[model samples]
Target: MFIALIALAVFFDFFDLMLSGSVTAALLTSGWSTRELNVVFLSVTGLGGIISNLVAGALADRFGRRRVFRGALLLVGLGTLACAAAPRMEFLIGARFIASLGMAAVPGVGLTLMNELLPVAVRGRWVSASGVISTSSLFAAALAGYLLLPWGGWHWMFIIPGAGCLVLYCLTAVLPESPRWLATRGRHEAARQALSKMHIDEDGPLLALNTLERSGEAPVDRLFTKALVKPLVLGVVLAVGFNVATTGFLTWLPMLLLERHLSISNTLAYNLMMSLGIPLGGLACTMLADRISRKAGIIGAAVTALLLAAAFPFTSGYALIGTGFVLQVSMGVLSTLIMGLYLAELYPTNVRARATALSMATVRLVMVFLPFLLLTLLNVAGVVGVMAVVVICLLVIVFAMFLLGIETSGKSLDRI
Candidate 1:
């Protein structure tokens, strides 16, 4: 039940993030002018998201996770509503960034809350299982955009997720705080209050965690302490590495496909087909998360993604579709399963949200300008050149996992 609620909170974020590329394409297909500015709009919105994550992550730590999480949700709803009502390309672009600002914090805040409340032994699997929910929503949203754009157009796409967010915001406005966060702040009673809300048995190992209350140390300062620097540094690098593939590439994929001589309908069709792997990879991660070492799984996923990405130029028909399926699945592992769970597990409760944000911020920064670079690269080197870059980035991910990966398997968050 607790996990279900967290999943519900994440649903809109997943939907909104995946919708950007399709939305851009949809707007173009609908005869909206200014094709050059669409990429800029996407980049600007991504920039807004990065800024929001950095601010919200720290604020969630300083204030409270539940409050910050709910507030972010409300913001996303507002952005979505604004988007639906946008009168022109300019208004839609501004509305897009407004929505991104609020939606940015969901992953970090949700990860912090989930890792803090759930058992350490099954934390990886539980988080990965939650990816099933998120990725499913992503696929659904993308497919919905694909189908709806031909009929009702882009306006309704925004409305669906926006309405979903408003309704969910109303329903889950008041949720339990993270007990680990409460304990980290030395609020024992508040910690117990959190547990009571979750209905977690009081006799569990949660109470056994030592609440190390260090006064006066800033949250960001704590993240950079000697013990955390390795994870922090590697996490930020891996975070950037991960984005070069999914958020960087996939976000621009629809337009890229159009550049490759595919029709808009065909582009959406391929995307709808490729999106099948989101849940497929998520489901695999759910099964393997606790069973295999996360480090091994991450390495494997990167290799798979690299190989499939490299094959894009040579294949078509079912072969192309197959590669696309596997590519998205592997990317899903890098994205939905590993990134969030890995970052959250690397930190203690006190600075977990901040660390998660700081790490994710690196990716968002890369992705903020990714559209411009991607367009330039496509013009100069074509899709194959872009794939080469993606391959290099995946290599970086593999090496980062080897050097800085922490074995969090079956271990408590406090012990990490």
Candidate 2:
């Protein structure tokens, strides 16, 4: 039940992120160009992402995770509905940025809450299973866009997740504060109350009744102290690299196909097929997330993504779909299960939300300019050019893992 609620939170984010390729592609078919799409439209969304991360992270650290989480969902709901009613290109981009900001606010608070609340032994397993629903939002967006674009036009695509967000926001009322977070803030009564709600006794071996132990560390203003610098560097690098690799590739896919002369209907179908890989990848992680160390899983997935990306531009038809499926399957594992979970565990509770938000913020800020770089690359080379950048980033991830690898498997968050 707890995991299911968390899945609801994860679902809205992917629903927000996944709609871009198809939604933007529909606009392109209606006459938006490559230059206009990137410089004018997508840039706003990128800017929104940056703002959301910084603001949301700080708010959660100061005010509390639950409030920020609720506000973020509200933003997504309202922004998405506004997007559906947008009258022009400028309005659509503006509304989308607002929605993106809401969804963007999620990772730090939402994942932090999850890491604090979930069981130690099965944390990886639960996060991986939740990822199945999260990543599958891409497929849902694609299929919804594919089906409804013909009915009420592409405008209706934004409405689906808008409604989903509003519904989930209401349901989130049932969630509790993190006992770990409450304890840190000198709310021992609240902490105990929250823990009691989870039905875990403090004397249990699982918690060792030690949910209240403090490491006596000073408050963290910087994400990088000497002890944290290595993992922080690796986490930021990996976040930037993986996002640039997959989203950078996937967001441009529809345009790439259109540029290659595929018809709109076929382009929609192709992207839908590609989106299928998200859940498949998530499912793969569900099986392997606890079985292997996260560092190994991430490294392996990154290498596989690089290989699949290398073969992407050359394939056609069923083979093309197959390649996309496998590529995203690997990325889904790398992203949702390994990297997201690993970064949260690397930092301690005091600064966990802030650190996670900083990494996420940096990733989103870098991604803001990705469309510009991708446009330049497409002009000079093509899909292969984008893949070249992705491969380089993946290689960086491999290096980061080897340099900063630390196993967090089966360890309590408090112990870490």
Candidate 3:
């Protein structure tokens, strides 16, 4: 069941990564003017992610993880088909938002559900596997682009995945709910029943629930309370820093390659090569997640990112490819580490999803302005110089994680 859910969630999570490389082609063929397409379609995509994540997090806390999990898949499937049939940019935008709600819900709640189900000893491995699944889907999406674009164009790109999501929704209903969430809601029998399905009979850990009860009716604003401030601030800052560097570099790589006198096909090939590097790096990091300190892993990955970003602009051929490989590996690892454990560590079970949502939302906001900023930076500073600035931001993240991040390996979600 765990393996199955991870596969389903990966299909949903990285569908956006697949779309990113091909969106311009899609927009050109769709016949919507740039004015309508940019503001409406892109805005809906970003906003849908933010709103869906926020709502899913809240619903996960108030109801249970499975409630949001099931609902999210249905929403994504419908949204995908809606996007396929979109007659105008506005209609597409709305449908994308609906799909995004389902898309975003999977991560925050899915992670929570996985953590709840697994014992601490294998928790890191479980989360790391989830990361690999997500990143691997990214590589697959790129492959899909290479194969599918010539035959069916963008609509089929979405149509196929949308149909796959429909099948996943059926599979999702058969999976067990989070026993931890059931226990907190005081449904002891239900919790036990769910746990039995997973072949466990022991009562689940109660630290998270006990902590929430002891906190005793604290207002939602307390998410930023003194004890929470360090992790919250660090989490948000690190999220923004990472996204700026990542989205900036990956978004412009093909154009950057073209500027260096490479042919268009070769430039795309390099990009595909980099995309292929993602899963390899992600898998390496996942293997160590259980063995290494989360903070140490993240700090190592950040410093490596800084180095890779600085090096990326100077080399080409084997050297450029080597640098891109290292950077993607580190970025893949750190992103998985941070998303898999950092947010889960920062907030107790009761508020974990909400806290993660807030940090992710801030990242999305930065992404909104990043495209133009990246273009300006590339024009002004050249690729090497732009990468240097990215390295500096990554340096800031290294410092933040070292000072403010918490170690979460083998810990209970509720205690975190």
Candidate 4:
């Protein structure tokens, strides 16, 4: 039940993230928005994400994971509800920005809580497993777009996830604070009580607490010190590289297909077919997450994705869909390892959320400019040119993983 709840949190995060692609495509087809307006919309959403990630990290570190998680859900719910009722492109963009404030932070907080709560030996697998559930959201979004876009239009897409988030917010009341975080803050009794909720014995909590380094200095300040700075930098590099590739490829997929002369229905159909790889990639990560070093997994998956991306521009019709499916699978593997396991494992309990959020903030910061960048690439050199850029980002990821990646598989969160 505990893992399931965390999985649901991750599911909604990915669901919301994936919706941007579908909603933008629908808006374009419906004549409600133009390409230029879409760029502004995406940029504003990214801006909101940047602000929310930093603030959410500090709040999670200062308050408790459970509290911040619930609060973020409420914000996402309210903002998404506003989006559903938006009357114009301008209002939708504003609502999307508001939704992003909460939407951006959900997965990071969910992963952090899972890292803190789960046992060390099984942590990577369970975290990756949650990603299996989360990645399915990609397929869910695609499926939703295919069904709802033609019949009910884009409004249903926002309405469903918005309502779902509100229900999930209420359900989060059953979640416990992170025991390791409590222990680091010197709240031993509270830590033990949290442990009890997990059915962990008192001795289990005591032994876990013994290994934790107590909180010191401001969590934000400690992030830049020598010991933490390396991982922090690595985290930022990996995140930026991944986001550049994904935000460029996945978010722009439908538009790219449309530019190829595919009709809206055909474009969405291709997307639905390609999205199948998301869950498959997550399943692969679940199988290999604990069996191999995360560094090895990231490098391998990135290389595979790079190869697939290079092949993308050369394929047509079913061939294009096949290449994309394989690419999504490879990306799915990278996503689970990097976001679900590697980033959270790099830091200790006290500063984990802040460190993760800081790295993620870089992702959003890059996102702010990506719409313009990708638009320029698409217009200048076409999809081939756009893919060349994705190829470059993947190459960077592979090089960085080989050079700076740390192995955290099977290591205790505190020990790392």
Highest TM-score among the candidates is held by which one?
Answer: 4
How many steric overlaps does candidate 1 have?
Answer: 0
Model 3, CA-based lDDT: 0.70
lDDT of each: 0.79, 0.78, 0.70, 0.86
Better of 1 and 4 by TM-score: 4
Off by over 4 Å in 3: 25-43, 86-94, 150-152, 204-218, 258-264, 379-389
**TM-scores, each model vs. reference:** 0.95, 0.94, 0.88, 0.97
Model 1 agreement with the true structure over 24-74: per-residue lDDT tens digits: 887777778446778778787778878888998889888888788878888
Error of 1 at 347 (Å): 1.0
Better of 1 and 3 by lDDT: 1
Which candidate achieves the best lDDT against the true structure? Answer: 4
Q: Give stretches of model 4 more than 4 Å off.
A: 202-212, 216-219
**lDDT tens per residue, model 4, 230-313:** 888889989899888987788788888887989989989999999989889999988889999988899999999999999998
Per-model C-alpha RMSD = 1.8, 2.2, 3.0, 1.5
Candidate 2's C-alpha runs over 4 A off are 32-34, 203-222
Q: Over the stretch 50-99, how does candidate 2's per-residue lDDT look in tens digits?
A: 88888887777767788898889989999999988988777888888889
Sort order, lDDT high to low = 4, 1, 2, 3
- Give the winner by lDDT: 1 or 4: 4
